[model samples]
Target: MVQSLARAGCEVTLVLKAPVRTGRLVDPLRGLPGVTVHSPHAAGRIPDHAVMVPRWAAGVLAELDEADPFDLVVVRGRQIAAKLAAGPLAGRLWTYLTDVPQHPAEFTGAAFGELRRIADASRMLLCQTEELRCFMESAVPATAGKSVLFPPVVALPEGLEPRAEGAPAGRALKLVYTGKFAPRWNTYEMTRLPARLTVDAEVHMIGDKVHVDPGDPGYAPRMQAALESAPGVVWHGGHPRAEAMRLTAACDVGLSWRHPSLDSSLELSTKLLECGLLNVPVVLNRTPMHERLFGADYPLFVATEDDVADALDRVAKDPELYALAAARCRAAAEDYTLDASSARLAGYLADAFPAADEKVLAAGGGRKLRVGIAGHDLKFFTRLLDYLNSRPDMEVRVDHWSALRVHDPAKGEELLDWADVILCEWCGPNALWYAERKRPGQRLLVRLHRFELYADWPRKLAIDNVDKVICVSPHYRDLTLAKTGWPSDKVVVIPNWVDDKQLDRPKLEGAEHHLGFIGLAPSRKRFDLALDVLEELRRDDPRFTLFVKSKLPWDYWWIWQKPEERAHFEEAFRRVRRSPLLSGGVVFDDYGRDVAAWLRRIGFVLSTSDDESFHLAPAEGMAAGAVPALLNWPGADTIYDTRWIHRSTTEMAQSIADTVRLGRWDADRRDGRAQVRAAYGLDEVCAQLVDALAGHAPADLGPAMMR
Candidate 1:
């Protein structure tokens, strides 16, 4: 977002929670005259800083109000950002939802409810494809006229030279696949391209380990040998996304392959759009998801392994068919561009918050005000609490009401009798009943996280009495409002904030062949794929060491409702756990505590999550100096474009091996901590929170509250 806005001539001032060292990524922006970047003091402990997640919320919002005011504000979540957008002094507030709330396989009644709420709250909503827009609109009637079907931006550097090979008319078929390749990619099959196809093809793969490690003991060698022995196959170790795109455009055939999984089954492929932008005809796997985006009549559809050759042959044989596919590709590319979507979205920003441009500061005008939250299970709420409490001027207080109900006649009255603001997270059954009985003027703030949206709680709660409703993501907000059938004006978007001070520190030098993953194993989390990547790494590079750490209690895995899914996950996790030794039973002699400590010895971190709201572990691991090997496309098409997301595990293993072979750790070693501190860190984010809050606080929010 910062990059696109900067390119569009906005005076881009990025106030990051941390500083990320993208090496040459910032070089172009550094040369830009209008771009200015700022870093604030991290909110928590100095070194190895903890994100003061709550305080940073209001702090950052307030800072933006004090700094140059923005004409339009687009917030990612319904958390703190929503509150700031609805607050006074804010301009056009556009709540943008990247993910449609519906989880294909994990939809408990609770998850479905959450999806509905987000759809209802959005005055203006953006969907990745027209099909997604239809889904969103059908799910929520409020979105019927207000939603816009726009694809995500295919962002490339403004003036980089186009790929060396333009549209291939008569060139040898050089096929290229880029991005993260995890177990979900079905890489064993991908690496067997020569065996799968009967045509003359040279395959080149550039992959990352964002989601899983393919170099583990069981799966690595076979995958590597498959590619190594394949005729005319060249594996380029993974490179940055921009570089990969440039190189991909040079090839004759572009591969945007995806193995259908819980997440992949519903996702719109970014690579397909990338290929389309470059006017490349894609031979895509035929799936309901792809059909939704490209329509059933689209020329590119591969039904089975047997169909692969014929599809390729047809494209090879007929120039007219090739030209037609290329033309369709170019036309399909138009919808995904940032320009087309931005134009349709600007109006929503104007309508949602008419007072955003008013320039009214907080109650005391630049002074911070402390706020308090009353909730339990602080794990999920901690970040918001920390950000709210971290500002130099803001103080935060939390009051836990064990098993307290928002609608309990006695509890609701007793809970907020003396509190400044009462925050109800996932309010229980009697929420509406209690909210109705509350005093007329009590400031009642209700928060709708993922749980409330997916569950039936929204239906039971009467949101009318609540003075404010807050959500974590715009998608969540839309989901909540749609499910709860609430007014759009009643909701707000506030994103969670993190502190990333460590991103600026110098990275370790000369260390190679280290991989790390810290997460609970699940299909949603993609632990199976992580193991595959590890297996692949071991086969491609012997010097490489796989580091695995799991803090999840073992009992979680033991208690599985679905035997098969649980068994699959457990077996994979076990393989990753046992992968520290070679076949002769030799231990690597070093495995550090936690992923961060392990990063000090390793060159890359495998962040393999199938679904995440905003993955903190991978970003944190990356900040700890582990080059992020991102699973390119995950649930809801979430991507962090941090030069880490790879396309395949083969690419990931090759990347690690190449780094070890060339003694070239420095070239790819990013100043991870700096990047985290600047953008993902807690302090800078808190300031933005303050600025956003001050800019959008309700007209009568009383004395300015600091984090």
Candidate 2:
């Protein structure tokens, strides 16, 4: 409303109850004309821009009336609304209520009722969506007779270029998601889709970090590494609205996802408008907001990730269909414009505060599901939520860290009551205890990538409550099961899925003498063994190539293991660097999945790890048709199948020799690719997860006994 009024030449006064970073606000709006920033700090000065630090309910109540009053005041959410009602401004205010506050019974307070009452008293209301407008009406039935307006588009700078569409013939399908994500957005959901969607579409995300505290010890670097190490997605950190829109304009699609909460159901996302205005076709799952906006626009609703390409296929084959959808998006957007919306709101305010908008009561009547995921490092989780929201069927309600002191089974039960399934990656020992004690109905599915087990944290994580534990590799699963004493029935081995496009990517020229392995953490990855493999190859053939890239510590080879083994491995790594076997101080390209080009040049890829799990390195190499020779073990064997496993160094060497002699792995190199397709392709694996969770209950409900 403010943006619209400002654009209309009004001297807009912006008030912030909380004093946030100047970099966050002032930097972006520094030079805008007719914009006055007001907060508690400048309450008495009446400066154009004022904000109060540590704003209290009492402080705002006392200050709002004393300051320069305007023709209109926009109260952003419930808290602001309450202040308007309880203070001297009550009879003279307009409520810009964006969301209906529906609190749990235990936490419900008089303030919530007061906020509703204040909104009811307002003559007019402004909401983000018609759904929101309806929700507000129901919450305060008396407001039904007053003025109401849908949320307005956040105005973009004039003359801004629209985001471009991908070229029909030459461009790969581009899928972009832009939004501020909390757990409710279901970012983890996206992780399931990348490996499933087979189109040449690139997935892009713009989101704020939700779970990790930058101030917390050891969090910053770990979070940074995870973002750096993610296999097949792009992350552009939070940007200004203008820059974000500019980025959005270059994409082909947009997404808005929410958990099944009354707040979510009543909410309409700003990105929806931005994407539509930018001519980016949106793909949404079934939701109240989606139904309200695009119910008749059948072409815009996609039910699955697989359905996405079909939607794009229509756009690809028929320009007119794309144009038609683009036009409807524009029409819906105009209905949400600030000028049109704020005008209706102005009239509502003129009539005096009436009653709460009646429609809100009806919008809050669903059995909203509240799912929770536990973890401290949220960068990965946020990405996961973004991905989940891409799915049309699932909605995540609560995504919060389990507080250590809050050993509340009721909290877990509350989530279980609302959740269909619990998707957990990180949890301490108590999480399981909490899950186990919850009322018998929820289903828990825990994901254990290699690091989770190798780090020795499971003993501390209460594992008994988890109904199905997902492991990325058979080797990791075996090790974890042996360590945790968890039954085999509780374990479900699901390898990390890779997109199919990665399988068919063009191979780079084979290395003259290069041998490569990718992954960090030298100890578990056995970079020392990588050195040994190189040395052994070099002894027989001087030109033998050796390339090792890992995130493991440099001195892990020199320390932190049995003395005899450490010395042996350290010598091996040192000798390889000094000897003819190594091709320079091995290029450690930190992390990224562009290893296909590197693997193509290498004659062979080798894994000499003492421990095993489904090694992504060899599976990826095999996907590129690069023959892999791994330490035959549980994880490696599971992925390669018995037919492809090599038992020893002699067998490993002979396997490579045979590949070279035969010129390919039989007449079925295509079959090699097919083997990976059947076993580890992204789409095939995600389908497996969807199937696993479909007939199940939420994990917190109880153990397998409940199932």
Candidate 3:
């Protein structure tokens, strides 16, 4: 990676945790142009190696940065990145994660917390695979746009020719394995492959044994015995990386078959990439990632130890299959070559750090536009606020309201006085206050969600003083005009944005049978309808389950205080407990900010609301690669495709069942994801919001409204 950066014209500074006494350690990078290595001395006692190493490294980096400011600082490990993130140079860090949690269940505790801190501090997150990038974005919502793909770069032997021959004609078929002999790697099991093959074969192993599983203490001894005594096996342990690659190049096939438990990991195997670069056919598991690299029809894919032995026999017998596998490996490996990786790095750097342009400043009259956002809850506008604050052409401040209709009068008046444009987040009292007090020439914009349109706040808002009223949907925009008698030109539609990059993640195993519904409050959200669908689906397929992520009725005082709402929820709970099928089928998870992670278990997101201006849950579900089954609420067709919209619970359940039974669930999910990304992507919608906040009125509005 350092070589790739240096090759891309970057002045790379390589930092080592400990000084290297032997020249062999740094021999590969020697004489590389524009690359420098630094190993700083630790002066004091090192209490804990994990904590002290990072601390000493951070101090050395701080000193180096002070002496010569770096355009960017790259760190590989999560621990080191977290330590450096606490210092002053956090903004310049480009964190490259070599190790990360593989499953959603693993994303917790202190290590995961450090990952989040590192993500929040780093300028860019370099991921080793597309799946890892998606996991990082979903696990930590902050790393959405900054998280990028930087797959493993294959380093081939110098002047090595790509193999064009089939399996050796007269001799044994040589096989190679080039990583650790951890229990999960199935190295011990691989040692027995030579005995099982129909043709004579040689198995070459080239790495030290790593004991990782404490539960099975006998694994290490068994592995040692197999490596030493197994027939036709030659264990060449712990060679230098270059030498290992050369040894692997001479082999006819690579062994990468592993335990099935690791099949769901979000990391790509570097060993597989090396084999591909050498044009050697590898016997590997049939994982989604491996299938993508080597097509599903690749002849060497194996699921079990017995399958591995069978695949080897078939490869030895068929020369045509051997050649095809070799060609496919070489073709797939071309994208991960050193030159290709360097070009990708250079492109990312160019896009991340563009040359400063004065056009935006000039357009804004030689200064940034001072925009003030006033609201009690900015949950819907959080991404927009972050976007506006990140821009060089705009300055933003916020006057946070204490309640829906309450705020500090002094702070509100001060913001009104200072801001060139005041954006009222909701058409609540803040809008009424800003509309009446905003000075002439200062633009005032009010955004009305569904709740406010039904409230008295919209009627009380001074529409004459407001420059524009932003509605999340065209339906709400028209309703606002009709209800408040607001001018048609003043009301404009700007749909809610979905962070597609953050939400788009791979579905977990058996997600097709799982359905999700978020927010079942206010009685109008129609929790009863969701139960009807779940009940109907379970009647046909008992594997179907409903995962409800919501705040319980008692959690919201407004809903619990009403007798009708209390009765509605109590009856629903009774029905769930009384039905034998529904008792274990329905799960109610606590509502929280980790919606993306929760969505992985959900294949279908249910929007069974009676009425909604613009329900965001279905869009978010689509972004997460989950098909949405939405009720045909009023104006729902305007926001979503009709295929997702159903008229009744029975129809919705039937659609979901048909999708699963016909194996069309994944295809529908892919289509829905693409559609939602095109319509409600964060960057696109935020850009539109910024234009409106900057006093750039819609084309339909007259020029008189524009600043």
Best by TM-score: 3
lDDT of 3 by residue, 1-707 (tens): 88899988899888767555677757567669988876553333332233447777788789889989998898888778899888988878899987777777878778678887888888889998877876676676677657877888987766776555676789998999998888888898889888999999989999885676689988888888888889989999889887898888888999988889989888887888888888898888898788778787999889888898888898899998888888888888888989999998997676555432354354356788788999999988876786776676777899999898778999988898888888999988889888889898888888889888898998888888988888877667777778989788889877888889768766777899999999989788998899999999998799999999999999999889999999999998999999876879999987877687789889999999988988999999999999999998987877888889998999999999999999999899999988887788876686577667666657453111101
Go through the candidates in order and give the clash count of each.
Answer: 152, 68, 0
Better of 2 and 3 by lDDT: 3
RMSD of each: 22.3, 22.4, 5.2
- Cα lDDT, all candidates: 0.55, 0.56, 0.83
lDDT (10s digit) by residue, model 2, range 1-707:
55555655557766655554555655444356787665554455333354433236435545544665655555566666665566656544566665456333322557456655775555456655554544444445445433255565655556777655433356665666676434445454543345545455555677556455445545545444434454445678787777788877877766654454523455667788877777777766666456556555647566555565567667656667766666666666776665765565454432332222222222223432234565444543442453343343455654454453344556555776667666765544434554565455666677766656656567766556667877665556677778889877777766665444334433433453556677645456666666655555555665555665554454454444666555655665577567655656355543443454345555556777776655667666666665556776655555675655667766665565556556764343455566776777655565555545553322222111100
Q: Give per-residue lDDT, candidate 2, residue 106.
A: 25
lDDT, model 1, position 64: 66
Q: How should the candidates be ordered by TM-score, best one leading?
A: 3, 1, 2
Residues 579-673 of candidate 1 have per-residue lDDT tens digits of 66333211232222223323455566676665555566666665556566767544222224445666777676676666667865555556544
Alpha-carbon TM-score of each model against the true structure: 0.44, 0.43, 0.82
Q: Which stretches of candidate 2 lie over 4 Å from their true place?
A: 6-11, 18-35, 42-71, 102-112, 164-167, 180-184, 191-194, 210-232, 257-264, 309-318, 345-707
Q: What is the lDDT of residue 415 in candidate 2?
A: 70
Clash pairs (backbone) in predicted model 3: none
